[model samples]
Target: MLLTKFDPFKQFKDLERSFYNYPSNNESVNGFVPIVNTREGESAYHIDVDLPGVKKEDIKVDISKDILTISGERKTKDEIKEEDYYKVETSFGKFTRSFTLPENIDIENIEARSDNGVLEVIIPKKEEQNSKKSIEIK
Candidate 1:
């Protein structure tokens, strides 16, 4: 028979690590996570991503089959002067986000725009077709 000791705080620690995206001891953190919001409208679907400090030119939107991917890089500004540092919390790195699109989406008509610090992607839905037909019986 084997015996093991159980710790009560193990679950909490695991949750904290996942929520903060803390890397493991053997891995290195490379990128930041951007907030995203998605909504479905009557005629289209909208994806809004919050990308503060990231320029429009640095962002790229791509689609492959039914997957929509948004990728970009945020560079750190060299504004540190020769003085005592208090606190630095700004994060800068490359980020990529992907979403699986529905079947009715019109890929050719999809469009994206950036205003302020938010990127909005509009995916227009395809028009519904009438497939029912009445046949005259003789």
Candidate 2:
């Protein structure tokens, strides 16, 4: 006898990825969906997001209500004609991505930098705060 476990929402997740035209290949750089990598260490969280062909001036990063947003745009050629190009796969226009930061993050200590079409953000975790309290009875 053999038993197999089934995932009820796997198909739904696949459908959602398809609906948004997410790239099938994880290493595809020309796709509309930029690849993102995140890592957590004892001191900080590191994030690397691929944003090819995007200008540094066009990129924006902000934190609002504990949500971190990274946004940018890639400009396409303006004079290219339909018959001039055989094929095109690069993604253009504005794209935005948001992430919810953990409570341990230090909002003011965050740092970001962009180099060679890749944006890197470093978020340092806040030191543990004392929560113990003594109340006097009235």
Which candidate leads the pack in TM-score?
A: 1
The global C-alpha lDDT for each of the candidates, from Candidate 1 onward, is 0.88, 0.85
Q: lDDT: which candidate is best?
A: 1
Residues 62-130 of candidate 2: C-alpha lDDT, one tens digit per residue: 999899999878787778876787887666777778989999999998999999999999999999889
Which pairs clash in the backbone of model 1? none
Model 1 has how many clashing residue pairs?
0
Model 2: residues with Cα > 4 Å off, grouped in runs: 1-31, 79-82, 130-138
Writing each residue's lDDT as its tens digit, candidate 1 over 1-138 gives 999899999999999879777664323366667789999999999999999999999999999988999999877776865354586555678889999999998899999999999999999999988889999999
